[model samples]
Target: MALSRQNQSFRIPCQQCPLREITHLRDFTADELEFVSRFKKGELVVEAGSTILVEGAHSAHLFTMLSGWAFRYKTLEDGRRQILNYLMPGDLVGLQGSIMGEMQHSVEALSPVILCVFERERLLTLYNLHPSLAFDITWIAAQEERILDEHLLSIGRRNALERAAYLIAFIFERGRRLELFDERRFIPLTQQHIADTLGLSIVHTNKTLKKLSSKGLLRWQERGCEILDPEGLLEVAGWTGLGEGKRPFV
Candidate 1:
């Protein structure tokens, strides 16, 4: 028997999952993998521009991003929406909602996305039966925290140029780590998205991006921006890059 969502069948085996093959990811033990296999409820395929989670809503399922890009955002009372962060493969969603009472932010898919679903009520089983999995959960949360901190720093303190550089470099490096970065790959983000993330006006964002493009640091494609000189972006951002690490993808 199989469960379904959104006119698609949900099926992915943990044993032969492709994410396990990512070089930076730690290999899961057989038992841990087995547990995770059973822990998964199904998969959900979300179309671009679809809202996957809503702010202040009760979430019934948690998700691990199998593929594609999404962003977490919060809308103020006056209707200004601030993009909190962009989410990518192997990132967890609804983690806070699974623990807390209601979701504090909304997630909107930027591209067609595949997400592995888990029963939110059973999340405690992973924590109680598998200490290592619980630790991985903690690690993921801390990683997200660091990203949020950096984003806040960029928006609150960094100048427009530095902010733009940091954002492009940051997205490039994360995509590069996932082996998904290339000239041919569409970034699935628009200038509007960048403006929202940086808290800049659309015109200001375009001007800043043009400066990077003129300097040969990046190029704007039809629907995406290309990282031509990642090193140059890094230099402008004053960022060293994400340090060496082993990440757990399950």
Candidate 2:
């Protein structure tokens, strides 16, 4: 797990960030942009399989996902793991650690990742001086809660096949919105990731995925999953969709 930290001279400027061009994210004001530029300390790059944040550790910095994929997970003493959720470009990381003083779950890079790093100590300064940005942070937290609520509903009530369908549809929709998928419609995930996320065994996860594939919904690849029929997967999962529109990010 190689980690690289770039000095501020190499950091991407906030005003010129590519993520800001995404239609789903709100545009920042001149003042807000200037503040964010200063707030961002530098950039951190980590390879796939790198642990960016560890459970029970205190980090002096927060991060905004600049590129690539990551996941939040928690593990038991016996080493059983549960994946809480996936992270994409524009997702904020380490907020829980900043506020709570320690991370409750670990974050790992699913793909080589670039992150915009910010000083955690300056969080309160932002809240005090910039009310709207503070509100955006609160909204981000609320959004995470809503996502977890849906995940709980799926794992607690949905059948194995339905759960698998829901997870695939969820990741596909997010990637589509973020323009992460190419012509191949690939998503970076494995059966083990799906099993951990859905709280199922590896064998059961494989069987459930095969059932979805038989229905012409998705295709499992060597190192990832290809979204073949997103609408069909959503229908099978009984999910309405992400319902996202011009979301905020700090």
Candidate 3:
């Protein structure tokens, strides 16, 4: 996924999708758009396992998720990786570094991912030229913080089955928001990744998944997961979107 001159024109398909309509680009002036368009058409946006920003590194650029998923992670001394957070379309990676020059966590693509990036100098110029851009960036940061809090609650208190159910429900709603998914379609994460995130063993994760299927929650397919009973799944997950004790599906 290294960006070379040969495949320069390859852009991520999700960049121009209809789902982007919900994302406001009011801060992008004609000049800003023109500058961004040059990088937009290049393959620099999508990369597999590419480190967008490393922990404790001088942060020079900010990334916007256009397609695929990414994680903010830190490796423990014993070599175990703690999954700090998961990101989706419209989410900004390492915005906290915009003011401070260093990143606290490393950001890597969870899959082949597409991102929109702006260098720190360029972003500062844009902010000075357009106060609206600064406002938008602040708003997006707040939303990201709220999401992290919700994930903390889910991973900390919920049981294995409930965690699985909560994750499924959250993914469904997120996909729907981005116009990238349907209830009949399956999610693409493997059981191993889910196990790691949910703090369960692979065997337990598989058993829990099978139990959900037997209970008529959904059908798990090779490519993704489908919700057979969206209502039932919601109940099992104990979802209360946008509340103080919310289940993190909003």
Candidate 4:
């Protein structure tokens, strides 16, 4: 069946669905969901290779992914682009501007995406009215901060192989937590995006990617970057899944 759009709340009946499983909405009550039920949403699932929201567009709506992946990126004046983060299902993208008023980065669909959008006005009201909702938003912001810290470390500290390995392991663990891991396949992130995320040139990124593939640690085939031996690379990167300074999620 198609997703329900009757009210601000949307219901996808397939509870065991991978994306649904990752969603953190279980803690929210039905009454607490009223504000979202009235939201104006996109009719079609935004396809991969499309812009979800442009940078500095007076972003008056906050988004929650009902399904699929997206990424946040920004371009510098010299035309150097950097992917700030890869956002999966259940991740909140626009909450950073709840107080600031506009997004600093552009958000684009990384895969076919279904989004639940709540207007800025309504979200502000809901945040003020429901402490739980506000707390959830706060937690999402903290998670973004954690990711930024790691991305900085990947660029500053790790070599190309280690940088790539850290990113692979990071996404792998996240996918595992949501039970979204596909042992036969890895996430379909683009080489260019990975290069930007790791702050490496595409040429260098390709060489490092080929090295990893040749080592049987991963396979960056036409389909996507598949992990052949996650353990091997994990040991090389020394990723503990803990934060740089403190325990993760502290």
The list of candidate 2 runs beyond 4 A from truth reads none
Clash pairs (backbone) in predicted model 1: none
Put down candidate 4 lDDT per residue, 2-75, tens digits, no spaces: 22232333444332324433442343355554544454443235777788766676776676776677788999
Scored by CA lDDT, what does every candidate get? Answer: 0.86, 0.92, 0.66, 0.69
lDDT of 3: 0.66
**Cα RMSD (angstroms) for every candidate in the order listed:** 2.8, 1.1, 4.9, 5.0
> CA lDDT of 121 in candidate 3?
64
What pairs collide in candidate 2?
none
Better of 1 and 4 by lDDT: 1
* Ranking according to lDDT, highest score first: 2, 1, 4, 3
Q: Which stretches of candidate 1 lie over 4 Å from their true place?
A: 1-9, 183-185
Instruction: Indicate the residue-level lDDT of 145 in model 1.
Output: 95
lDDT of 3 at 100: 81
User: Per the 3 Å backbone cut-off, how many clashing residue pairs does candidate 1 have?
Assistant: 0
* TM-score-sorted candidate list, best first: 2, 1, 4, 3
Candidate 4 residue pairs that clash:
7-37, 8-36, 8-37, 8-38, 9-37
lDDT of 2 at 247: 84
lDDT of 2 at 223: 74
Query: Which has the higher TM-score value, candidate number 1 or candidate number 3?
Result: 1
